[model samples]
Target chain A: MNRQELVNLIREKQSYLCVGLDTDIHKIPKHLLSHPDPIFAFNKAIIDATRDLCVAYKINTAFYECMGIRGWESLQRTVDYIPSGIFTIADAKRGDIGNTATQYAKTFFETYRFDAVTVAPYMGKDSVEPFLAFSEKWAIVLGLTSNEGSKDFQMQRVGEGYLYEKVLKTTMEWGTPDNLMFVIGATQTAQLGEIRKLVPHHFFLVPGVGAQGGSLKDISAVAMNADCGLLVNASRAVIYAGNGEDFAQDARRAAQEYQQEMAAYLAEKLAVKQ
Target chain B: MNRQELVNLIREKQSYLCVGLDTDIHKIPKHLLSHPDPIFAFNKAIIDATRDLCVAYKINTAFYECMGIRGWESLQRTVDYIPSGIFTIADAKRGDIGNTATQYAKTFFETYRFDAVTVAPYMGKDSVEPFLAFSEKWAIVLGLTSNEGSKDFQMQRVGEGYLYEKVLKTTMEWGTPDNLMFVIGATQTAQLGEIRKLVPHHFFLVPGVGAQGGSLKDISAVAMNADCGLLVNASRAVIYAGNGEDFAQDARRAAQEYQQEMAAYLAEKLAVKQ
Candidate 1:
């Protein structure tokens, strides 16, 4: 999960897809419910089906945490199950004061062993700096989120630019492209190019592509950098593609489609210096 | 708990003190390490000693989450161990996109049975609204943090006021006083009066009172309203007051001192309609 390694991942796979495992119990196939840990069994299937189709897996911690201790057990199993070569992200939007923030950093980076954990920048530098301290580990700070709530503060005027613009600019100073990335939503592709210009070298973990309805072609066209610095995440669109017994195969089909499309984008857009 | 219930608890106890359980294994007395669940054991002792001295207990989730599933077990036991009338807060500081935010709200409110969960407002209204959707549960949103990093985005100019000011103003619109509160850090007592004016009715969960160095006297003078609308939190200052065989007694003494000061404030400032 260093900068160079991520670059190599996209280049080697010809895909920058970061499949998001936002596995909710209520939404999963009923047959899997009888399994001791349905969340893990489902995730295991998804990872097995699509590991080669993507460069990374982003586990949305909220989904697991809702189930309480058992949910964490599921989360533990899922993170452990994901292959090491594929970069893993705990998309847990955690932020707090100094020492407490360090504990959160340890939760994801040390205990769960995720390559990166998404951080909220509202608390500012100290809340985020703890995540960047771990070598090769990453802190994907929220920039322009895909949700409707993004307009509430992110799009507001802050000095000369929008609040998210300030966030991207200010946060880059805290950590280099190696240990830091921004969660730039794909739904707001209008600002993607502007954001790309603002933080040229840093990777963007784009999360609005699939279920949230952002065209992958549009995002890949504008956002991909010389290093192929983009991790396009698809959560519900891929994982919940089908609810049948062959759900894993259905998920595989969806992932393969994304990978194939991303491969095309990689061919046209990626300009890695070999 | 509802606002009335919380107010009644404060009136009955004559203390707005929130004993923060930021229990770290390394910080706990070595004698407790022999226990099966040392974190829970330490927290039990502290709670047994100080349950009468405080109106609420804020479990800083980061401390428990760092230990993973076992850590969550400790959290479960500690929250369940607290007496029924005392308020419980999962100081998780979690925020995410809409549906995901609902999951976090469920994690803290439904699963954990916390009366309130601290939320970061960087994602805006939708992220915070779900936490308010619960009947009596509360969302304690971050307004002005205590750390030096608070100067970063929070203090920056946003239109006519600081970013944190806009956050306070805009976020209040999402939830009523019953289900919403703001974390107004105590160190910045200068802004307490101004923030009190901006957010008149809402309860403010004030940290930085003890270990982080904020005056309980100043915060109460400016921030206390008709309902004694403040929960002054002191984690390390109360929980880790001593590291010996009589640690619980020492914790009780520290908590008693805060409760004593708070009791006086409750008499002077708390002006209930009854």
Candidate 2:
């Protein structure tokens, strides 16, 4: 999906909500276990339940990768099952040397058909540039992550600003607002406004809203741009909303609540712009 | 494998050589394409020919992931085909949140049975600590990469030291030398001596020996500890040594040359210690 198309989808839906499919087979309802591919079945139901409520779905590749070949199959099936026009993200934090990175670009973009794949910027521009080479596809580089480890290197002082600030500034030069995005944790709400000022036009895939204890209101308030340039992701809180056979229904409820909250945020932002 | 076991393997082989299986389907000998699984077939042939000379095999995950399910199958088979006691590395530069990192730890260490998996440290300690939790398994965090892009964040000055230096110092606290290693690219020979001083006991998986134009002698001169603490990797130069029917034989010849050079380095180091 192109920049204009994604922005239009977010506008039309009144929610830049991205439901993260960090599905764990063990966490799924027991009834679904008997099925050949429980992960895919669970994801299909969740997509069916919440497709209208969100603008994108982010599949955390680590969850599927643990199952070996079967897991890979489930990943392919899950991505295939999601409806088109809704942006897809392969949350595979992959990066390597130039040629090796091109192969990874082929894996996520060509083979898996994800609209974007999260990439680590530690290896720098060459590692990330391969993913940005694709038309309409995106390279969401790690900026200020939500995890405690984010302080290890990302928050360390680099020149005049933090390391992540350097990452955001330097990486933006490699790709435009159209193809490059940044994964700025929603937990870093204090920095969101400053980050927005840094890269105002580029979209931010903000993970850590639900189970990670980030406030949706706080993140959306500061981070949303003229195009509602933010994809607020919620994983565990939505997917495992209930553990019984009505898990999908419960997940839909959780998603609807987030969508409703996001809708209000979008409306308020639009009204302010007008 | 533990630190002692790896050191012993290097001593027994008289080489700290790591053969990289960066098998590209398009680049493989045309004759092998007739086989049902050419990637695995090519990997099998290469392993058979060079298993004794090299102490480890580092499978670059990108080449396999690009092929999708069949590629994953090939990755499994290739790892399984390697003889026991030869350390296997899934050169999958993966990192994410704590929970997600656990799943990745499971994917490479538990499911794939790799001895070590390279991890990008842009996300920090939580992203790395899970990989360290697995007994005898290795995390192999990226310290200084071989690519030109390494200069982007890694070479950026942070306080008194460079960014990669801070990465090395901070990440070292999360895991002992037994379960943790750092990828200090062979291309950065000038810094190897200093990096060795920073983390004297830890192993370094040094890539960019041949095709990327890194000097083996210079790296070994400064980086080699008493245990021969280096797994210098040469992928393209060694793996794609020939394009004809004798490709595997030619690969073996290329690997043998590297092993011979490494053995000489080890012998000199041992002599100096004595």
| Interface RMSD for all numbered candidates | 0.8, 0.6
Fnat score for model 2: 0.98
* lDDT string, candidate 2, A1-274, tens digits: 9999998898888888899999998899999999989999999999999999999999999999999999999999999999999999999999897889999999999999999999999999899999989988999999999988888888999989999999999999999999999999988899989999999999999999989999999998898889888999999989999999999999999999999999999899987764
| Per-model TM-score on C-alpha atoms | 0.99, 0.99
Residue range B1-274, candidate 1, lDDT tens digits: 8999999999998899999999999999999999999999999999999999899999999999999999999999999999988999999999987899999999988898999999999999889988989998999999999998899899989999999999999998888899999999899999999999999999999999888999999999999999989999999999889999999999999999999998888887754554
Report the number of the highest-DockQ candidate: 2
lDDT of 2 by residue, B1-274 (tens): 8888999899889888999999999999999999999999999999998898999999999999999999999999998999989999999999887889999999999999999999999988889999999999999999998889999999999999999999999999999989999999988889999999999999999999999899999999999999888999988888899889888899989999999998899988887664
Clashes of each: 0, 0
Residue A158 lDDT, candidate 2, scale 0-100: 91
CAPRI verdict on model 1? Answer: high
